[model samples]
Target: MTGYLVRRVGQMGLTLFLIITLTFFLVEAQPGDYASFYVLNPDLPPDVKEKIRAAFGLDKPLWQQYLIHLKNTFTGNFGVSFGHFPRPVMDVLAERIPRTLVLFLTATAASFYLGFFLGKAIAWRRGGLFEYVATISGATLFTAFTPAFALMMIWIFAFRLDWFPLWGNSCIGGLALDILKHMVLPVATLTLISFAGTMLLTRNSMLETIREDYVMAARAKGLPERQVRDRHAARNAMLPVVTSLVYSLIFAIDGSVIIEGVFSWPGTGMTLLSAVRSEDLPLVMGAMLFIGCCRCWLT
Candidate 1:
């Protein structure tokens, strides 16, 4: 395991390096320089703009800028934010990463576990109420619906009707309850968007596994139904789910941006999104490379 981890980490590092190189060139390839933002602004004087560009080494040769950027990056300096005053990109990101993480980690854990157990139950029962309802409720909707609309439906039906809280964060006051409160809408949203795909995948895969020769052999040997299902069928059925879930986690990390944007939650995803929009090269590249390395890890 130790050797495996070491190899994976090294591979992740190489993947990240390549991401940095690729993004650096791509960002540079976009129209105009970072200084152009100021130069085109009606309010800024040309002389001050030149000085700002010079000070930030924006006026330097591209190769020199790349070398300097890499050196600073190696030393943990992600560079100054063009938008924020007296703030480093890393610091800005660090402050928000936790809150965004809270939203995603909460939503994902809820989505995956609930989907897994419910899916397994539905698979076993096949034609039951849970199966029918889960198939219907989960099948037609997705994250495509407006978040607020869905949340409002849940709030009016579930919370206003006494099913759950309408708005709250579980991160403070009382750790568990606060989390439950804040988690209500976002978790529900994620779960709703997530349930159908997972359920369908698990149900289909599990049905296939139960019919396999090994499961039949176990049954012939008089293993209990539960034992046959869990030991033989469950493990095999879940292998793909486990791998897919890991890939989903990587997507969660990057995809959190949109959900974060919707919820006004802070996380690396939104920060990266902002960086891309602002054309803050260092921050954009840092985020892209970080996300890419994470994706490589999942793969």
Candidate 2:
């Protein structure tokens, strides 16, 4: 286990290096200069550009800039935003990380577990009315187009129609009522969007799993169907699901740009989108790198 963990850590470090290297150079070495991000006044002297360059050490060689970026990154400094923000990159991430995590983790777990248990039920009683009806219903409710519409409809019904709050996290009050209120919409949207895919994946995985020799052998040995499925089938079936889940998670985070924007949630997803629109290169690149690291962690 220790050896395995060490190898995984090494892989994580390698992934980080690749991500940072790509993010740093790709954003820093973009086609146009970072100068346009400043006051683009025609009358502003070129000397001002030189001064700006000198201040940020942009006049240095690209290799030197790379070294500086790497050194600063190691020291927990994400460099000054090419735009006006005074705070470091880490500080911005710290502020927004919780919201993103809460949404993403909540959604992922909701999908994953529901997929697991529910798929088990469907499998245990395949060809029955419940399975047939559920499959049809799941297909509609969890269709790809549904997330945006579902969330919006929910907002309209739950918020505009005098139900739940239209926006924001309600976890602050620590009371069950408040927490449940805040979570209702986002959680429902995420689960609805994710449920079908997860369920389908689980159904397929479990179906294949149960066909394997061991499942038949388990039943032959008088092992209960529950034990056969949960112990012998579920774990083996989940391997592919786990692999699919990693990519789904990455895509989900990326897709959260749309979801978070819609909800006006103060998450890293929203922060990054705003930074990108503002051309805040450092923040944009920092967010990109952060997401890459998250992907690596999932991997």
Candidate 3:
């Protein structure tokens, strides 16, 4: 187990290195740097543009910039953000990370519980109408276009029914209840789309597990049906489901980019989007690196 863990960690380190390198070059390859808007203005003289580049170290050669970025990344010094000027990249991300965690973690828990419960029920009663209905519905939802579904949910719940706020993270006063209220639509959107996959996986796993010899032995021993199902079948079926749960939680960090954007949530996802649009290389690179690290180590 020690050797296995060491190997996994080493692989994750290599993957993270590749992710950092690729992100740096891709971001640098963009047509203009953070000062492009100021540099491109017709009124700005050549000297001013040169000054702007010098201020941000854009005057450095590409290789030098890459090396500097790599060194800073390893040292956990993500420099000041071009978008949120005068603020360090880490400081900007610090404020946003908690919001993203709250939203995605809550959604993941909700989806897993709902999916697992429904999956077990449907699998246990294999031939029932409820099983068919749930399977069909789950498949449909699993295949739905995420952004469009989110928009439709907003239209129905927020716009048409006025049941929830249209967007944004919180209301005035920043009450916990107000924050939860704002989270409802986006959280529900993510949960609804996600639960289907979990449900199907659980259902399939349960089906296979129930056919195993150990399950039949449990039943043959005159165990109560519920005991036989829960203690025997469901417990064993959980192996694959647990793996799926880990992946869901890890990737949800990256997935938040879209969900947060649609709901106007004040999370890292929205922060990254704004940074990219504004050509904030430090902030963007920091966010990408943070996400890559999460995906790597958390697995």
Best by lDDT: 3
lDDT of 1 by residue, 1-299 (tens): 99998998898788867777777789889986666655777788878889978977888999998888778767888876665323776777677667666776777777777767777778878998878988887776644564565556566755678665543322434576665555566666776677566677788889988889999999999999889877888888987776667666776776766665554444667677777777676667666666676677677
Per-residue lDDT over 1-299 for candidate 2, one digit per residue giving the tens place of the 0 to 100 score: 99999999999999899888989877766655555666477787889978876877788998998898889877888865665466777888887787788888888888888777777779877899988877887887776674467567666877679577776644543577766676667767777677777778888888888899988999999998888889998889888777777777876787777777766566787788888777788788788887888889877
Show pairs that collide, candidate 1.
158-163, 168-182, 169-178, 169-182, 170-178, 170-179
Cα lDDT of model 3 by residue, 82-132, tens digit: 675559988988888888888899999999999998999899999999999
Between candidates 2 and 3, which one is better according to lDDT? 3
Candidate 1 regions with alpha-carbon error over 4 angstroms: 1-14, 29-48, 127-132, 142-180, 212-232, 274-282
Q: What is the full ranking by lDDT, best candidate first?
A: 3, 2, 1
Whole-model Cα lDDT per candidate? 0.71, 0.77, 0.87
**Cα-based RMSD of the predictions, in order?**
4.5, 4.1, 2.2
RMSD of 3: 2.2
